[model samples]
Target: MPISDFRKKKLLYVFNVFFDVNQSGTIDRKDFELAIEKICSLRGWPSGSPQYTKTFDSMITIWEGLKKRADSNKDGQVSVEEWASMWDEYAKNPDNALEWQTQYLRFMFELEDASGDGTIDVDEFTSVCSCYGLDVAECRLAYQRMAEGKQEVTYDQFVALWKQFFTSENPSDPGNFIFGKTKF
Candidate 1:
């Protein structure tokens, strides 16, 4: 099914408002750099730290994917129109969206699974949520629901959350909390 116009609008709003942290009116490499920097600072992972280097690289890789998958005009930034086009296509074919989201899910999971134990505990969850400017409290609840009493989140579960966060329309769904404190 084609994604509703409203859903597309909400996604775009998130990109324009939160993802475009530099207020550049478009999603670009600088915006991504600023975000990664914030994450590193908050985590106290300074330059040369393994986590910092890995996260920085992963974010850059993700940004590259966004450019390849969504930067239609290919002018070096993802304009609203380009984003809309990619999302609209994904809305029409959710599987296509998954193909794009899976890589991100793996990289994000690696970044957040700080323990290196292959599981995502509450602290890890909180750190990642905070990085995204999401409400940690709300995400706590969501994480509980996802983990379902498990101490760690499996990669399969992480992938499922990625799918749900982007594809589900019900705002109350736990996956909706993936972005943290969304206005919609």
Candidate 2:
């Protein structure tokens, strides 16, 4: 599928966040989350919410996916140098939307998995919202609903949810986008 204008804008914002933190075109896990948090704060997201939790989960999912292709050093963590290498590889072939989305999902997961504990906490949840310009309370409600039947959203589930939120035919439906805004 062709990339939507909204998705392009969202991806560009994400890229800008990456560049802002990894100005040298490199990023460690901490740097990555910090950048996301900064972006979320700029976007006016509340300090806590289910939406934030979902965002955090999404970051982790993104990192996990990227880990497959970018963790060439086998260090179990993405270092700044490794990120530079990965970014180069991505830039060389930026047209692959699926790859880009997968990488993004993993990045989201990493953001949520603060403390490197492989699980999300309240603070991490708030921090993720602070990066995505979301309202904490509103996000929490959404996250609660999304996670109601499941303890955690898996990678594939994350992708499906993200696609529904960002690329669905009816973006205006609050039932569609995780955060409610159609344009991301």
Candidate 3:
């Protein structure tokens, strides 16, 4: 089955905010490369450093896995339709998408949890969003809604939100704010 319009909107937010870094209207290896560079830069990992090397390798592995799973037409790029279709499947049978999704989620959690304290505070969430060029104020509000007045969100909590972001189409789901504001 195809994804609902609401679900597609949420998925598009994730795609545009994270995957389609180059704004190329499609997801490809270049987007993943740019993502690695952006993330490494945000973490202050100089290109020759071990951190940069490990991040680069991990991102490449993620890209390879995404392309293999989502690039259904063998076109070397994932179009919007392809992305929507992939998520549709993920929404149905999560295990089919678990491996790459888990890796990606861990990477994102690490990026957002700047203090390395195994949890993400509202400040860290806002800071990461600000670094990503999102509005800090809006990010704070979104975090409030996502955390439901909690001071911090642990990795397991974030994992639940991540799952909701991928699987739920309900308008009230807090996971919709996982990427900050959504269109609907």
Candidate 4:
């Protein structure tokens, strides 16, 4: 099953914020590359080093996926309009939607699990959630539910949570906690 329109849009909105690294009101492959470069620099990764290949490759893979799917104009880039409107097209096709969701989860986990520990700590969780414009305090509470008393969320746990978040419509599910409290 595909996620609800509201939930799916919320996911896209968060990703749009993260991908638009330059705040240029658009997102493209260059933005993903720049984001990786900055992230590597901040982590003290050496220039021209191979240590950052996994991170860089993951971003490139995601960019390719987005371009192949969401670049409606075939213009070799994804505009804000294309990002926002792609879900409307994907939602009508459950198989395509699920494929995107699964692939997206893999990409996001690779990005957020910065320590290569196969888990996301609170700080990482908070940083990812912030992109969605979700309040920090509310995210704090939601993190607890998602973490389920653990200090971090493992890839398996994250996958289960994402599956629920993507496919379930019930508000009571912890997956609904992805963005914390939704304000009208």
Against the hidden true structure, what lDDT does model 1 obtain? Answer: 0.73
Candidate 4: residue pairs that collide: none
**lDDT of every model, 2 decimals:** 0.73, 0.52, 0.85, 0.68
For model 1, the superposed segments whose C-alpha errors exceed 4 Å read: 13-18, 94-100, 145-151
Ranking by lDDT: 3, 1, 4, 2
TM-scores, each model vs. reference: 0.79, 0.41, 0.94, 0.70
Top lDDT hit: 3
Error of 1 at 158 (Å): 1.1
Cα deviation of 107 in candidate 4 (Å)? 3.4
The alpha-carbon RMSD values of the candidates against the true structure, listed in the order shown, are 3.0, 10.5, 1.4, 4.0
Can you write out model 1's per-residue Cα lDDT over 1-184, one digit (the tens) per residue? 5566656756776686456879888999999899889878877889889978987888888788888888877799988778777766665666665443566678768767877788888888878777666777876776776665677887877777666666677766655545544446
Give lDDT tens digits, candidate 2, residues 1-184.
4455554554444444443365544434555566556645644555576646655556556666666666687766655445445544543454444464556656665655565656544445556654556566655655545444445555555555655544444444333434322345
lDDT of 4 by residue, 1-184 (tens): 4446666566565555557777776678788888788667655666667757866876788778888878888988777667756755544554456454567678678666778889888777766566446677767777877777689888988877766655555656766555444421
lDDT per residue (tens digit) for residues 1-184 in model 3: 6688898888888888889999999999999988888888888999989989988888888888888889989999999888888788888976566577778889889889989999999988987776667888899998998898899999999988988888887878888788877346
Model 2, residue 167: distance off in Å is 2.2
The residue ranges of model 2 lying beyond 4 angstroms of the native Cα positions read 1-98, 115-124, 170-184
Q: Is candidate 2 or candidate 3 better by lDDT?
A: 3
